[model samples]
Target chain A: MTTALLRIPAVRLATHLRRLGAAALVVASVLTAPDPARASREQTGDDDGCARDGADLPLAGAHFAPRRVEGGVAWDARFVVASDAASSFRGGALRFAAPLPAGEELVAAPGLGAIVEDGRIAGLCVGAGARSGRTVLASFFQPLSGDGASALGAPIAAGRAVQIVDTSVGDARLELVGAPLFEKHVGFVAPRAVSPGAREEARRLAGVREDVSASPIYLRGEDARGGLTVRVVDARARAETSAIAVGVAFAGVVGGLVLAARRLRRAASVERADALLASEIDAAAKEPAG
Target chain B: MTTFVTILDIACGRPIPAEDSGRARRLQLVVFALLASLAFAGAWGLAAGSQAAGLAIANLYKVPMVILLSCVFAAPAGLLAWRLSGAPVRGTDLALGFSGGVFGGTLVLAVLAPLVALYYQSSAWAGPLLGIGSAALALVVGTVMFVRGTIRRLPPGAPKLAALLPVVVTLGMQLLTLLQLAAIAAPIFPERTPFSGGIDHLAR
Candidate 1:
C-alpha cells in the first residue's frame, strides 16, 4: 500500500516538471527575438520610449571633409544647426566617432570644439536664439603616423559616424537630416563608389521614397563597386571557326557559288547545244524523204 | 573565286534563269553558312585578345554547332512556309532558301572582317555595335530573299496571301535559330557590353 501511494505522487511530480519546461521555452523566445537596432523605427520623431522629446527642436546637417595630413589623415567636420531653432541649439554639444587609430595623439584647432579624451566634443555654445543657420561645433587635426594605418585602415573606406545631442531637450539625442554615416571622398573623384548591394538598396529605396515608376535600375559592372562595364554576348551570337570547319564552310559557300554560276552559264549552253542537234537531225530526215 | 563572287551577287538578288536556280540556290546556302561561321571565328579571335590563336582553335567547334542548330531550327519552318504559301514545297528548296538568307546576312560580316578585327583590337563598342547591325541587316535581307525566292517557286495559281504567310513563319523560325546561335556562341563571344552607359574609365 505504501509503495503504491508513493508511485502516484512521483508520477504527479514528473508531470509538473514537463509542464514547467515547456512554459520556460515559450518565455525565452519571446524575450530574445531579434536585434533591437534593426527593429528601431524611431525615425518619425514619435515619443515611443523617449524620456524627453528632442524631436522638432532642430534638424542638423553634419559635413565631414577628409584631408591627407602630414603624418596621417585630418577631418574638417562642420555641424550646421537649423536657423529656426536658434535658442534650443545654442548650448547644444556635438559628438563624433573618433576616426583616429589607437594610441595616436589628436591635436584640435583652437577655435574647434574642446576635445575630450576618447573622441567626445564639448565647449561648443550655440548663440542665443539669434543667429540661426550654421554654427561650427568643432574642427580638429590629428597626426596619424605610427598606428595610423590600423586606425585609418583603408582611406577610401566608409566614414566614421556623427552623433548630435541638443541641450534644450535635456541633452536628448537629435536625429540628423542626412544619413548617420557619410561616405567621404577626399578630392575631385568620380561618383561615390557604391557597392552592388548599396546600389540595389538605393534603387529600391528611391522607388519607395519617390513617386516614380517602380522599374529598378539594374547596373552591370566588373565588381560590386559601381564602375560600369558592358556585356556583349546574346542568343543570336555564334562561334564555329576551326581550320577544318572554316574549310568546309568555305567550300560550301565557294562550291555553291561556283555551281550556281556554272549552271547559269550552262543553262544557255545546253539550250543552244540541243537546238543545233535538232536542226541537224531534221535536215537529215528531209534529205532522205526527198 | 570568280564563281564564288558571282554566286554572292546572285544571293544579293541578281536575277538568274529559272533552270539554273536550283543549283544556284544550293550554292548560295553553303556560302552564307560558311561566311557566318567565319564571322563567329572573328568575334572569338577579337575577344580572345592575347589568347586569340588558342581561343580561335578551341572555339572552332562553335562554327558547325551553330550551323547545325540554325538548320535544325529553320528547316521545319521553311517547309511550313512552303506549304502554307502553296508553293511546290520541296524540302531541299525551302532548306536552300532559308540557308541563303543566313548566308546573305553573314556575308555582310564576312565582307567586313578586317574592320571587325581592327575594332575588336582597339575599341570596345565598335565590334559589338557592328555585330548587332550586321545581324539586323542580315535578318531583313534574308527574310526578303526567302519570301521572294519562295514566291518565285510557287505554283502559277497560288493565292497572293500565301506569299505573306511564309514571311511570318520563316522569319520567326530564323530568328529563333539566330537567337539559339547567339546563346550557344555566347560562351565564346561573351557579352562585352550589353548597353552603353558612358565611356568606360579604361577607354577614357
Candidate 2:
C-alpha cells in the first residue's frame, strides 16, 4: 500500500480517481447485478442454529451469485423445462445439520463416494472442515416442471448433466427427500420426511432455534461472528439484453466502414477524373484564342 | 477532486475520498465479473430443464445473425471509447482480446448451452449468454484497438468532429450485418434453427 504513496500526484489525479471510481462502481454493480432473489434478512431462526448471515460469507461460499438466491433462497425447485431430451439426468442430495454453514454437507451419499462432513460448496468452504472440497455439488429437487429422467439425488458429474432443487443457503440437501432425490420415484412425502427429520436432528444437535414454517421453513440464527440477524430480502436484478445487442450492432459497423471507405475512394477517383478533364478543356480553349 | 467537487456542486452525485477509492476497483472487477456470472447463468440457468430446446437453436447461422445485429448497436459506442479516451491503449490488442473474449466466451457458452438446457430454469442462459458474448467481444476488440495505438491521441479537444467518425462507421456496419442476417434467416428459420435436434442436427 505504501508503494502507491511514493509516486507524486498529478494535477488531474483527483479527477482521474473520481472518474475511475465512478466507472468502477458501475462495473461492479453491473457485474454483481444478478444478485440472488432470496431475502438475506437476518430473521430469527426457529431454534435451528444454522450459522452466519449469507452476507458475511464470501460469494465463493454459496457458489451462486446473490441474484440467484434473491428469490428467497429456494428451499427446493422442480424442473419445468428441458433444453434437451437426449441429455442424461442423475439425482443428487446433500444433508445438512444445524450450526452448519450454508452449502455444507453433514452427511454424504454414495454417488460421490460417501464424503464425510466437510463444508465446501462448489470449491468454496463454508466452515473450517477437513477435506471439505471433496464434497460434490449436489441438487436435491426434481428437474422443475420439465420432462427428463431424474438423476435422483446423485453426485453432479462435473460435465454430466443434472438439475438443482435447493436455492437457499445453510440448508442441507436431503438425498432421500425430494422426488428427484428418491430412488425409483419413491413419491415426494416419504423422502421429504426422512430428510427433514435428519435436518431437524442436526439442528437440535447444534442447540439453535428450530425453523418450522409451513411447507418450507427458513432457519435464522446469530451470525458466526454473532452479528444481529436482520431479515434482508434480496431482489434479483434483470439482466438487460440490449447491452449485448449493442455488440452485434458493432460488428455491422465494422463492415459498414469498409463499404463507406470504398464509396469514398470511388468518389475521390471520379472527382480526380473530372478535374483532369476540365484542365484539358481549358488548354484546348486557350489554344484557339492563341 | 475538482471533478468530484464540481459534480457535487452540480448535485448530480457526491462521494468522499474513501468512498471514491473503494468504489473504483470494485466496480471494474464487478463489470468484468458480469461475463463470468452470465456464463454461469448460460451454462446452468433455465437450461437445467430444457437441453433439447437449446440444442435445437444452436445453429451456425445464429453466429452471423448475432454478429450482424450486435455490431449495428455496439459499433458506435465502441468507436466512442476508442476515439475519446485520453489514456493510452493498444487498438489491435484491445480488439483481439475483446473479440477473443467474446467469441471464445460465446463458443464456450454455445457448446454447453445445450447441456445446460438439460436442467430446469436453465434456458434463461441462452439470450443472456448471446448478449454477453456479443458485448464482451465488441468491448474487448474496442479496448484492444485503443491500446494498440491504432487511435492516435488528439490535440487538446482536437477530435472535435473527427472523434465521432469511428462511431458513425461502426453504426453503418452493424446495421448492414443485422439486415443481412434477418434477410437470410427469414427464409430458413425453424429448419435453420437446431431446437428440434432432427435431421438437420445430424447434418451438423
Candidate 3:
C-alpha cells in the first residue's frame, strides 16, 4: 500500500499543490486588504483632515478696488493663484455667492471662460496651463448699481484638479480631481479717492469691528460653499475701550465720594458748635435776674 | 452756601434754630432743598442714561420730574395727616424736613453716579440691577433720615406717634407715586426690569 501511494502520478500531485497554493493566496489577500469604509470614517472624524488633504491645491487671493464707471461704481477685481513648487493646478472655477451686477461682463484671462446663468456672471474658469508656484491670473471689472461694496461676495475656487508629487510614495504622483478649494486671502483696496475715514466708516457700517492691519482677511474653514467667514481681531480694542471707560468712571466716583465725605464732616462740626452755642444761651436765659 | 449748610444740618438731625423755625424761613429752606435735590437726582439720571445719548438727554429731565411730581402728589396728604394727628409739628417744618430727606437721598444717588455709568457700559445684567439697587438704597437712607429729622424737630412733650403718622403717610404716598412715575419714564435702564413697567408689568 505504501509503494502504491508513492507511485502516484506526478501531474496529479502538482495540480493538487497548485490548487492549495491558490486558496492560501486568496485568504492572505482577504486578511491584509484595507477597509475603504473604515478609512473614510476615520478621515471624516478628523477636524483638520480636509485642509490637510488639499494642502497641495493652489490658493487664491483677491483684491477688489472700487471704480467710478459711467453708470455707477464698478469693482476692479484682481485674482492671484499660487501653490508650492511640487504641486500643479488646472481647470477650476472661481464662483461668487452674490449674483453679478446686471449687464456686466466678466473679462478674465486668455484661456479662462465665464459661466453665466440667469444673466449673471456666476463664475470664471481656468481652461489650460497647470498653475504652479505664484501666478497672477487676470484682472476683471465688475460693475454694480451702487458702490458695489455691499453687493460683492468673496471669491471661491471650485472643481480644481490638483497634482502633487508624493515623496512618501517614492516619487509617485497623486492627483485630486476637482475639489472645492478656498481663497487664502481676500481684501478691499480702497480707491485713491476714498479717504481713510470713509473706509473706516464703511467698515463700521458693515459691522466689521476687526482690525485688518495684520493681514488680509482669509476664509477660516474647510467649507468653501459657506462663503467667506471673517475672524474678529478687534476684541482687544473693545476690551481696552471698556477698561478705560470703567477706570475713569471709578476714579470719578472715588474722588466724588472723598470730597462729599469731607464736606459732610465740616458741616457736622459746624452744626455741633451751633448746638453748643444755643445751649449756652439757654443756660444764661434761665439764670436768675441780676 | 448758607442754605446748603442748613440743609446739611437738617440731614444730620441737628435742631432747627428758634429764629429760623419761623414759617417763612422754613418755607425758604424747603425751596432751596428742593432745588438742590433736583440737581443731585438729575446728575444720577444722567449717569444711568449714559447707555445712549438720547436716553441721557431724556433722563436729565425725567428723573427730576418724577421726584417733583411725587412730592407734589404726596405733600398735601402728609400735611392733612399732620393736622389730624395734632402732632404740634409745624407744616413748614415738616416740609423742610421732607425736602432735606430728598436732598440727602439725591446726594447719595449723585455719589453713586459714576459707578452706575461704569456698570452701564461694561455689564448688561449688572447695569440695570445696579441702577435699581442704588435707587432702592437711596430710598431706604432717605426714609431713615426723614424719620430722624422730623422726630428731632418735634416739640418737647409732643406724641412721637402723632408726628410719625404724617411721615408714614407721606412715605407711602411717595413710593406709590414713584412706582407709577417710573413706569411712565420707561426705558430708564438699558434693559427692562419689573420696576420699569411698574405694577401692570408685574401683574402680567
Candidate 4:
C-alpha cells in the first residue's frame, strides 16, 4: 500500500517540491556570498576628529583648460580640496576678482554643495573624510569674451585665498595663481551625461541650452601639511584623437575605393567600345559589300 | 510610400533583397555620405545644445572622423564575416547591406532627435535616457535588418545557424571600434571614473 501511494502522481509531486526547496536554499546562499571588491575608492578618516593646527589643514587647488565654444573660448576650471577629515569643508566663500556677469553661472558638480550668493559662490562642502585624498569639489564656467568677459577681468589675480571655513578647521584658503590660463590649440570635448540624474543635474545647473563641459586636469599639490599630493588632468584628448584618426582613415579608404571603382567602370566601358568597333569592321569585311 | 514601407519592413526583420546588387553598392556611397552627415548632426546637437552653427562646424571635421572610425572597424569586420559565411555575398552587396543597416538606424534616430532636444529642455534626466534608449533601439533594428538580409540571400538549404557566426563576430568587432570611437567623440560620464571617491552628497 505504501508503494502504491508512492507510485501515484500526486505523491510524486513531493520530489518537485524538494527540488524547489533545494534550489531556494542554493539561491539564498549565492545571494548572501561575500561582496566583491568595489570600484570606488575607500573612504579614509583622520585620527583626530578636528584639525589641530596648520599641519592638519586640508589643501586646496585649482587648474583650468581652455575650450573653444561658439564664437569664443571658455575657461573650464576645477577647484579641489585634499582633506583628511570626515567633513573637509562646512561652508565658505569662493572669491573671484571680477564678479561673474549675469547669464553666466558657476555650475557646481553634483554632491559638492555650492550656492551662488551676491554674485559670488559660497556654501562649499565635502561629504567624504579627507583620507580619500583629492576630490574635484567644483567647476567654474566662464566664457572668454563678450558679456562673459567681465566674469574674469583682465589681470585677474590668482593665488588669492579662496576661503573654506567651518567650525572644526576654523578657516582654510585655496590660493589661486594669477595669470591667464589658455592652451594654444584645444580640441572640442563633447559632454556626456551617463546617468539620468547626472544629465538632469547638468542641465539644471548649466542651463537647458548649453552642454556642461569639464575636462579633467589633475593638479598635484600638498595640503598646508605638505604630505599628500593629488593629481587631476583632462585625459579626454587621447580618446578624441583616436576617434578623429579612425574617422579620417575610414573615410580615406572608402573614398579611394569609390574613386578606384569608378575608374575601373570607365576603363571597362572603353574596352567594350574598342571591342565592338573591331567586331563591326570584321563583319563589314566578311560581308564583301557595303 | 513604397520606399517607406520597405524601410519599415527592413526594420521589422524582413529586408528586401537588392534587385541590382551593383547599383545597391553604388547607392551605399551616397548612404555613407548621408550617414556621416546625420551622425555629426546628431552628435553636435547632443553636445552643443542651442548652438546651430556648432553643428555645422562639427559636421565639417568631426563627422568625417567618426565615419572613418566606423569604416575602419566595421569594414574589416564585415569583410571577414563575408569571407567566413562562405563568400555568399559580393563585396558591394555587403557594403550596401551594412551601410543600409546603419542608415536605417540613423533615420530612426533622426526622427527622435527633436524629441531628445525637447526632453532635454523639460527635464535633465530625460535627455540621457532618451539618447541611450534611441541608440539602443537603432542598433538593434539596424543589426537585425543587416543580419536577416544576409541570411535571406543565402542559397536554399544552407544552415541558418552558420550565418549567425559571422554576424556575431562582426558585431563584436563593431562594438570594440565604437567604444574606441566613443572614448573620443563623447565625454566620459563624470561619475563612471575608476576613482569613485566616497563623497557622500547626501551629507549636503
TM-score of each: 0.38, 0.22, 0.43, 0.41
Candidate 2 residue-wise lDDT, B21-107, digit = tens: 222222322222223323433343223223345533333334433443554355456656656753233343223223333333344
* lDDT tens digits, residue span B21-105, model 3: 5444566667667767778888999999999999998778678767766776789999989998887787877887798888889
Displacement of the residue A57 alpha carbon in candidate 2, Å: 26
Q: Name every residue pair that clashes in candidate 3.
A: none
TM-score of chain A of each: 0.28, 0.19, 0.32, 0.27
**Proportion of true inter-chain contacts also present in candidate 3:** 0.00
As for lDDT, the candidate ahead, 2 or 3, is 3
- Model 3: lDDT equals 0.59
The segments of candidate 2 whose C-alpha lies over 4 angstroms from its true place after superposition are A1-165, A168-290, B1-70, B78-204
Name the best candidate (by TM-score). Answer: 3
DockQ (Cα-based) per candidate? 0.08, 0.03, 0.03, 0.10
Instruction: Give the distance in Å from residue A227's predicted Cα in candidate 1 to where it truly belongs.
Output: 38
Residue A213 miss distance in model 3 (angstroms): 56
Kindly report the TM-score of the first chain in candidate 2. 0.19
**Chain A TM-score (model 4):** 0.27
Model 3 chain B weakest lDDT span, ten residues long: B195-204
Q: Which lDDT tens digits does candidate 4 get at residues A160-256?
A: 2221111010011111222123111121111121233433333343223221222221112211111111111224433456656666676676577
Order of models, best lDDT first:
3, 4, 1, 2
Residue-level lDDT of model 1, residues A1-290, one tens digit each, is 99999999999999999999999997897688584422332122112212122132242334334444576445544454545655444343222233233433334333222323343221222223222344443334544444211322111111221111111111111111222132322211112444544543433422223212111122111111221111112112113233344346545654554566556565544654566677778878889563
